[model samples]
Target: MTIGKTPPRGETIYWVNGKHPWVSISDMVEYGTILTTKEKVSVNAEKLFGDITPTGTLLMSFKLTVGRTAILSIEAYHNEAIISIYPFIDNEYSARNYLFYILPIIANLGDSKDAIKGKTLNSKSLYNLLTPLPPLKEQKRIVAKIEELFDKLK
Candidate 1:
């Protein structure tokens, strides 16, 4: 559970175009898997950003548009407004699909207590958030059920 780097600016920033996929909140889609972003940076920027977020990482935007989630399908660097999670680590009571469905609800429920702007969710907000944690098997079952129900809507 690490937040993204501060965006590069001034001479430290280089537009490398495709060498590095840089994700910002706008690039994320509802329940989408992100393989490429609308922006990119050079190795210089990556160094400044500190890490090449590995593929398959689960990411959620915790800023102004709180709780928009996505899984990275390509190695990428994202802005400070996002946080990346190692899926297999705490992916326990949380399924990617489940989070996609639940986080926004939690964010909305606590909006009045957050920063005096749009509902911005941050690490502290995350730590304070209390959610139901069923067994891992039940989580998987719930995700499957949600998907099945959504598929029926198509």
Candidate 2:
């Protein structure tokens, strides 16, 4: 329920998944963020979606089909449909996967009105939701389990 204080374009703004053709809007658009292979000091907006953010931010879909969450694993900018979260500043640090898991719960808890017809969860409605925060250690454990299960699938 708190409005985040965002720095200007270059001050504290770091985009992850900096590669185009990576960050997409569902299955239609493509390459929303940017791509950088920098080992450190890099964030990626694409992988952030269903992925993680290191020294990063969270991106929530804002347009069309909204409320989808993303994490900044690398530094990059995101589309307007996404609301970025800087856990470092907010003191809300948790594993990116943990955010992905809990965001769905928040979205379901929030109000749902079909403003754009089928798109009931637009950016405005989705971003205003709140969820509980688990300790970083617990989050890490959860993320590890998530990765372990996902790795089994591959």
Q: Could you tell me the lDDT of residue 49 within candidate 1?
A: 74
User: Which segments of candidate 1 are over 4 A away from where they belong?
Assistant: 16-18, 87-94, 111-117
Local accuracy of candidate 1 as per-residue lDDT tens digits, 122-154 = 567776776565666777888888779989998
Per model, how many backbone clashes are there? 0, 26
Residue range with the least summed lDDT across 10 consecutive positions in model 1: 87-96
Cα lDDT, model 1, residue 133? 57
Query: What is the lDDT of every predicted structure here?
Result: 0.74, 0.48
The positional error of residue 68 in candidate 2, measured at the CA in angstroms, is 2.2
TM-score of each: 0.82, 0.52
